[model samples]
Target: MINPHKQQIIKPKKAVIKWLLDSDPAIRWQVMRDLTKEPDEFIVAERKRVATEGWVAQLLALQDADGKWGGVIFPAKWASTFYALLLLRDMGLEPTSEQARKAVSLVRHKVTWGQEHGNSPFFEGEVEPCINGRVLALGAYFGGASDQLVDRLLSEQLEDGGWNCEAPPSRRSSFNTTICVLDGLLAYENAKGACTAVTDARLRGQEYLLVRGMFRRLSTGEVIDRSWLRFSFPPTWHYDVLRGLDYLRSARVEPDEQVIEAVDLVAKKQHQNGRWPLQNPHLDQVNFAMEGPAATASRWNTLRALRVLDWYYR
Candidate 1:
């Protein structure tokens, strides 16, 4: 496994870097911190713009007075407040900003899992490992996720060292559910500081991916899902190669033989121009376009892929 430490950042093409930097504050700040290694002050200053500019502003403006987006708690259209929070987390909205505090506070007081889950508070989370995992991440990021939520998630872990929303009937873990839970669990650890149970579960979850080579069926050694090769942003609950690699990068997992194939797939996806195309764009019903339609150069996917590659190669 490769340890990602004070390793030098990889030098992406200047034009590609320019393309990335010239865009939304959400993406630009990440590029500075991860790719360009800008001074923390510059990165912080740029990150603050997310509360006032570009996609972040657009998304925030769509919010209703009720602290809900898309007018639902969790809707099939991805228009729900749940998704809005997820997207905000992905955008790296400055946690301390007034916009973030106000927005999150509204979610905390006004939203609920509805009568179905006993109208559970937003940060308290509802059933379904997939949904709770994302909720855990949002709460942790914005500072509301609870220890009770963490405890519930810990109890639901399947024997396979990962989670499955459909655990009771199938007893088999799922890649989609596993990634969502891992993201939440990791975020919880980062926000609350690691404890033995959370840390152990998180590490075991990583092993589950590593043993399967990230996107393979362990029993037959065949690609589990071809669509996993299609990269996306605001990924929702989907699991893709780039998503898997990016998670490892964020978690600071050491790169090893297990990730070589996945890393190569990301490298191969880059266009001759050095930008990666958006192979998939997870449904956004809110009318906000984070990138051009699929097959076009995508700043979000390109930025994520570049950082993941840097973590792997360095």
Candidate 2:
């Protein structure tokens, strides 16, 4: 006798899986592993192609001989080494690959915070929690020694249980900054485990998001920003409810009452065909088009949303 609940949980939409599998190597690799539960051998084979083909390959090819992209770091929009490294990380590139190793090394030696604080090295990080958070993430993901930087960010957490980039020890936290820092702390802890301080800090930060229900004003229960309802890919510094839920799902967080409203907002955005449209895309320079413009069914957004819902419903 089959368990009907288990069957319902495991059943997948075949058409959606087909559409996702037909995308770039990056997207296809994630779809196979996350949604389809394909065998390890098949997923590894597809993931290997990401370094040599399509947009991921194009971005790798754009790396300069000196190891930086666009010959400068930061302030160059999406064309600099900072954005390039962030993009590569998002594409799930292998941190130990030849290109990635060299790029990480170059960033360590060549890039600096640019005279803002005696030109601190890339991994040393500057004062802002938002910037330091990104540095921690990129450094840890690419195998840089970011322990000191991680400690600094953890200390910067405010009494409110979150971080604000505008000023350290602010009475309140900014959603944008807190999310970025949370992502960084999560990456650091994943790469190098056994730090109880980091774990506690991450939980507090999660509570900060949960207390406000991810998008509402805690005091008034009003939606804080209409833009938080829109979905976007490669979000950069922006914060959205979908992005927040996706992060929570990645962190293996169990569903909580605080997340119900945000989850409903996500479900409400689904189209008749069970797809989510791209509502925003960062308008900046890049290697190539990763997804179609806004208003179209976005493979990136759809993949993220589906997996998020899968975790939520299960």
* Top candidate when judged by lDDT against the true structure: 1
* lDDT for 21 (candidate 2): 83
User: Can you give the lDDT of residue 125 in candidate 2?
Assistant: 82
The residue-by-residue lDDT of candidate 2 on 1-314, one tens digit each, is 22223333345467777887888998989988888889999999898888888878899888887767888777777888878888888887878877677767877887787886788888888888887898899888888747888888887889889999875335789899999999999988888885799999999999999999999998998988999999998888899999999999989999878888888778778776757899978868765778888999998888888777778877
Tens digits of per-residue lDDT for model 1 on 194-263? 7999999999999999999999989999999999999988788899999999999999999989887787
Q: What TM-score fits each model?
A: 0.96, 0.93
Cα RMSD (angstroms) for every candidate in the order listed? 2.8, 3.2
Give candidate 1 regions above 4 Å deviation. Answer: 1-9
Candidate 2 vs. true structure, TM-score:
0.93
**Candidate 2 deviant stretches above 4 angstroms:** 1-12
